[model samples]
Target: MARQEPLVRAASAVRTVVEQGADDGYAGLEISGDRVLLWWKGAPPPAVTDTARAAGVAVEVRAAEHSREELRAAADRLWRSSGVEHGGQLQAVKIISDGRGLEAAVRPGRKSPLAPLPELGVPVDVVEQEPPTPTSRCDDGVPWYGGLAIRPSGEWGGACGGNENLRYTCTGGFGVHIGSTEYLLTAGHCATVGETLLDGAGQYIGEATLRHAEHDLVLVRTDAADRIWDGVPGVSDFTKPVVGWVWTFPGQSLCYSGATSGANCGYTVVKDEYTKFCYEGRCWSDLIAAKRKGRFSVAGGDSGGPVFSLINNSAWIQAAGTVTGTLQQTDLLGNKTEWVIFQDFGTATRDWPGLDTINYLDPM
Candidate 1:
């Protein structure tokens, strides 16, 4: 049997009426069920009314500044007259007018029935909620992990091609003192040959002296030094210690970081061989996996953000790895691939066959 195309009727009917000696305005159209709704910025010409009559569409007119209730009443009447018993498929034509311009949208009807109106005399005002803080306590001290908190200082190009200026954004991943003075770790991609890191004030901090492209790890050096801590701390007198290494394990609780989403704590889903294909090299392997679920989380701009673990009373801690991949899925079980992987200092040296000779970082 031949199938028929589903009907796509207009959401509402519209007609325009213009005031004499005023410029005639145009109407916006929206579709809902079999009806087409019309909205206009100013009074429309009588021609608009003739056009609607020709199309056999009903028309409703309201002042440009009609209240929500007033608009709803008109729509309800139109919906009832149209014989649309269920409100779910109802559509509305909305119009807004400023002296200079007009805008319109065709909106689907409310999914659910409107809730009972609030008490008539009650005062109401909308309030926005503040975001939760991302810092947490660990053995070393408190650390900033999540949110779009990383601020860029300055940028230089010339890494990928001939004098190509690469815009560098400032992040917390570069020159992170893991354990040893010789092995500074950061996002591999960030350590491009011609790139540099800048501070919040746009001062040059370090140069991308070394990089592991496959694992996306970079190593750099700077004159500044500070003691790294594990947990979130208030103002204190404890001298900050330099972190050389971080201990991590499978299923250990840890935090994932990025510039925009900030930090989120998730367990190590897996710590096995993670093979990553690079844009210019063979597949790389052996990366850590950190997973978390929260409203504020990681995204693309956070590629080299650090993943940290707190353990042993927050006394012993080290960098587990860097974020490399993110996965998107249509189902909860993630049966499909939506993964984003990052290269870290250790993984880059370990996986890339030629990286050790090129960048001087020892194999993990």
Candidate 2:
């Protein structure tokens, strides 16, 4: 005969223990293979323990003062040692309460008192704290030459590929550096992978390290280089936008940029959507459609470019979402022809986490 499944035995044992409890006795039962766990509060009786023992079940109890980590470790050890293999995964762990277990008491730091858990009359174990927020860093800026500006750091290349002939490229955007090594942020998509992009002048300086991705941010590192100013037009103080930085909205001013477009400004038209522009690609975000008639708007090879809002005669630049264009309509002899119409469209920093990760201090 096949070996008996431990989970089935555990379930049966748990059912037996629950049946022996009085109407107001055992709070609940948790089963894991041949092991049965029961919860109770405000003083449990010996009869509950006796019933569990009769069913060949090991009892692991908890109290409010007990840490969650301690209880979890004990449960893990018990499951391993019981010789039971199936269904040992814990579903949930909760502290049983009778509605009057929380009492407020004041402490030192503030005006509010500390609220501790009241005595639950059960065994509680210590628990571990949640993980910390990830970070990345790049103290010095990257170098730029010709039309290509190389930053010494960037997040992992999630999906990076380019076509030289067509001049189109897409890099799963990564987190940008804000400050020291400890505080870094990046786009959520970039952080999914563990990698970075690097470029150095005379030496191989540093590499891009991904801290976390949920906010679409990454941190990179380099030599302890002081921040430098190139005094170029349109390059806002990385420390802060000039003043009055508003997101793209209807009738609001906007601009498009990239290594190719140079930098052209426009006005906003539409606001939000997964819009389809040139090349049949769809971009999703709060759309900032521009209404400026310029020689060149957004073009290929401009993903992850910065979009700026012109407010109070100052330029406040932020990462524009994605750049797209439209298809132009041409008329010929009672027929209409479709052609690629390149325009500027993008999302604003207000909709992304880029602005929150850094403090815009006066230019240093």
Q: What is the TM-score of each candidate against the true structure?
A: 0.41, 0.34
What residue runs in model 2 are displaced by over 4 Å at the alpha carbon?
Answer: 1-192, 199-245, 275-288, 315-364
Query: Please, what's the RMSD in Å of model 2?
Result: 24.9
Q: Write the per-residue lDDT of candidate 1 for residues 151-226, one digit (tens) a residue.
A: 2234432111111232223234523432333323456544475566553234455566666654556665544332
Q: Can you write out model 2's per-residue Cα lDDT over 317-339, one digit (the tens) per residue?
A: 43333233322222354443221
Q: Which consecutive 10 residues in model 2 have the weakest lDDT in total?
A: 129-138
Best by TM-score: 1
